[model samples]
Target: MSAEVRELVRTYLPEFPIQYCKSLVTDTTQFMSIDYGHVIELGDVHYMVYKNEAERRFGLEDPKYWVKRCHELETGKRKILKLEFFETFPVQVGKFRVECYRSPDKESRILDIVRGDSRFMQGITIKDAAGRNVRVLEIVNGRRLDLTVDRIDVEHDVYFREHLPGLLRRYLEAVRAIGMLHRHGERHGDIRRDHLYVEHGTGNLCWIDFDYTFHSYEHPFGLDLFGLGNILVFLVGKANITVQSLEGMGLAERLEGRLSSDDLSIVIPNRIVNLRKIYPYVPEALNRVLMHFSNSAEVFYTTTDELLADLEPCVEALESEYGRKPE
Candidate 1:
């Protein structure tokens, strides 16, 4: 068990503690039937499983234990249980190729790195009975960032005027937290708008889903940077303003500027990275920050610090344009 788990993480998760992997010994395969009143132990901790909406509606034939909500009997607290899953995907950006994987071990390591940081979702890692790692995370009380952004009812100009700056600041906080991951020699691995949770009470932007893993000959944090760029576009446009997203709204003549192949993402070209052409009033500096990830971008962000550096001035510019003092 020790040898097998070590080989798995050492290959898939870089800089991970192999001995830690060796200690965890059981896969949560039996957890599928965990219904209401079921009591299970993970490491030294025990949890009483309750019926989530999916289980209540569908009657417990669920296979995915990656997102199970549980009530900790010992601590008498609610937490989420994530079982180990093995997934690998390939992503291409220009000439660079990246292989992304879902590694629970890596996420466990990151849980240690960001244990107390409220800017991120909280979680604890422990080994299950069959040498598998399980992540018991806080039940984040928040809405998905994408959904929260989607619920905003405003035109592009109004959103830009009233909302974008604040959203950008919060996103900068998240990007900086990703920098913390980099500082610890890890990446967010999966960075989607949905992975972000906007806390209900505090309005703090919390990051979830740190189980993504990839190592490349190109820049290590390159894909993370790419994901950051995608989120930036989402914030700037108030949603993911793709050509398809904007299709019914106008013809080519309705846009303020012409679209070129360069204005799109090199990997996913349909996403219009250059927001200035459509919004017209989007700050040029902010648009250039977005373009850093576009097909036309001569160079990409080498480090999170670089990305943060580029955006700081854009924050100031945005505040000035909105006639508000920069925070």
Candidate 2:
């Protein structure tokens, strides 16, 4: 079965040398071996060549056909009955892994945005054997800030203090990246700790996932700033207190029980309490900035530049005090 799939891959992409091939198995019954087929890697590129049975069942022979079907569904022109059968394969191009989109138009737009900005994950479009327009993006080799913070020893004051300067610097860089996006008249509608990546070795920060980004003509950018504040809270407090976490904690129920029925101001003071409780080591100056921005009513920073300006002084002070001097 593996050999057969390898032959299929070679037939489709004969130019590249096949480096490795592995059969993807779904189940093994007592009498039958249900092999989903082989995912073959040719040089730096990977392709999932489905078995004959799987191809007949899923109609995945022509990638573009399914992509067009998705477009019809999205535009309300068609309704899909069985959506579970759909699956996507990842391909590698150069240094990045490519996610092929069904809609050539959507893929083209994404590629344009990525190519126009260096802050975004680099991407390109290529036509597959079936002439399907596929989008491939460079895989970011770094850890998300949220995951990175979880691994830090925040409980140890000295250890955390020593590393705080570098963390603050990276945080500033992340903010600056967002500011750059705004200057280009784009808004990253979705900004979270996981979306911001600190590149390995270089320590350069890059933003990923632009599925929700859109052009905003408005000058005041608060939503992204609000996200930046949440990121700061994560960095300084070493805690993941997001809207999802709040929802899980029954924040709505608590607010209903405590606040007056007529009072429109729905303030959550306990958020600050939790930050201070979890990270007692957070400096007072930094804490003030976090609290001010995190509070929706404060209106402390209308733009990313203002937030960066306010944050720079605090970060610089921390670097001077705790940063290791060059030997």
Candidate 3:
């Protein structure tokens, strides 16, 4: 990552201990990496420093200070991330009372023992100064889902355009993982394409960024749904209105001067037409899911289970259509 990228990440996470340091031989911008010195450990869990501008925006310094901030927040008070403070650190930052932090090691343990989906991340852990630990996940290799490849393309050796069906299947598997989180009453706060890692050889989708997951609340599942739609749109080569575009359009013009959440939802639709128009090959069942996801007006699927149920039939139908079998 470059200084600009580090700044961008810092904008979201102000306390991220790593700073934009030296350039690498690789053709990428300089960005922060773990300082290692700031790490702290507690009860078998490791934490890494994390901070963002939202801490000030929401006046949530006290909330962010707690070892387990999610558990401490009252569900009735916060509806997932309707407010700004509960934004970037999407999933559980610490073992908060309201939420449970999934260890990167746990996922790694499964990957190490399991023979399938070998593309998942291996064992890695990092601790931070605030004792706010998180599973260090690899950033997505290509373009961020919300931006067109041309706009925010990341040059990487791994590309999977040639295997469309394979790509879709991998995506479905990754959704199943998200479904697991949903089953546990948690919603992945960020589900964009850039958050998903593609195993170099297998071309499988690996879900990353469990930082801002919403847990056990009557919160709208819209964020996850919207993110899923964004991923699908990107997989097929389309752009959704991203933060970059929002910045470019001038927030006032984009929002028509309505800065409220109600107005913000309209921004993406205004810029990106729809994913369906971009990929005709997208199955009808999947399309229905996308439709529900893209809907800004209604709360369609209350949980990932509901969405997965709707998708099950589609997966089966596709498998049967070409005598495909799960590998």
Candidate 4:
């Protein structure tokens, strides 16, 4: 987290101020996952490789494709940089060899570019091939609270009755995070379990990985709202629930047994059902929130606001039911 420590950690990467020589250019056809990263050596000097022929052969040039590149930095530990981008003009231009270009200054400029992008995520250290300072962000580690629906044995209502409040809190946080991005006209294109990192200690939900974070896009809020709904269902152990299953399962019996069904079509694929099948006893007010999101009619909230609204009552219900605040 410190600057000295960060620089020391980056030494394994190609040292700063290095640029591609003209001769380095090749067909680049075989390089599938093309990258413009620098190769660092122990001498504290940097070497620029335009393309990895092997990677090209395997079709890595595409950006959305994720592949890990590991090399021993000066610290002897392998620093892993996940090449996550598509093959395109930017990559091609970046691959263009540049020897005469000022590597140090270029690195600085790239750093500036990175800093200017609000979509960029924090925590990891970035540097140019020459290993010049890019930008270092504050550490924000995501929490892991994975509760897959298939993993729970309790009936839906029982689980919802018991855990809905806490789950709602996390859901609200996710909605708010989405709203924050929406306010800036950005969208977390991919909002999955892996992308969301919750800070259990702080009751905070942090978004991670900006490789697919989108800017300059409208309607991102709607997409994000759908994603939040999916996530909320996931938390409540209904991510995998099906309409047929809900149909066959009696809502009265389900509520008696503590189960609630999710009917949000956006959250899943083609389904309409009530929460009762999963958790029959869920508070009517809370159930309405779930129903609205499930139906995509909760208009007052951007996905984030809806998420919190749905969750707050549940949190209060949880506290009153358990005699303690649910985490």
Which parts of model 2 have CA positions greater than 4 angstroms off?
1-46, 49-119, 126-133, 154-156, 214-220, 241-270, 273-281, 324-327
Candidate 3 Cα outliers beyond 4 Å, as residue runs: 1-162, 214-217, 237-267, 271-285, 295-299, 315-327
Writing each residue's lDDT as its tens digit, candidate 3 over 206-305 gives 6654445445354455567656655655554333444346566454353444333322223153433233333346566666665564424354555666
TM-score of 1: 0.83
What is candidate 2's TM-score against the reference? 0.57
Evaluated with lDDT, which candidate comes out highest? Answer: 1
Which candidate would rank higher by TM-score, 1 or 4? 1
The candidate, 2 or 3, that scores higher on lDDT is 2
- Give me the overall lDDT of model 4: 0.45
Q: TM-scores of all models?
A: 0.83, 0.57, 0.46, 0.55
For 42-88, candidate 2 gives per-residue lDDT tens digits of 22344353232111112235322221111111122221111111234
RMSD for each of the candidates: 9.9, 13.0, 14.4, 11.5
Ranking by lDDT: 1, 2, 4, 3
The lDDT, on a scale of 0 to 1, for candidate 1 is 0.76
Q: After best superposition, candidate 1 residue 209: deviation in angstroms?
A: 0.9
Query: CA lDDT of 113 in candidate 3?
Result: 39
- On TM-score, the stronger of 2 and 4 is 2
Summarize candidate 4's per-residue lDDT along 1-327 as a digit string, tens digits.
233323433554435333321222122222343344434232342223333222221235443222333333433443333332332121111112211111223223333344533223343434434443322233344444453334447766666666556656655656665566656545565566545665646655566444343221333355455556556556654544565554466544444434333353434544443454455565666666556555445452455765676667776776587544355
lDDT of 1 by residue, 102-127 (tens): 89889999989999998888888877
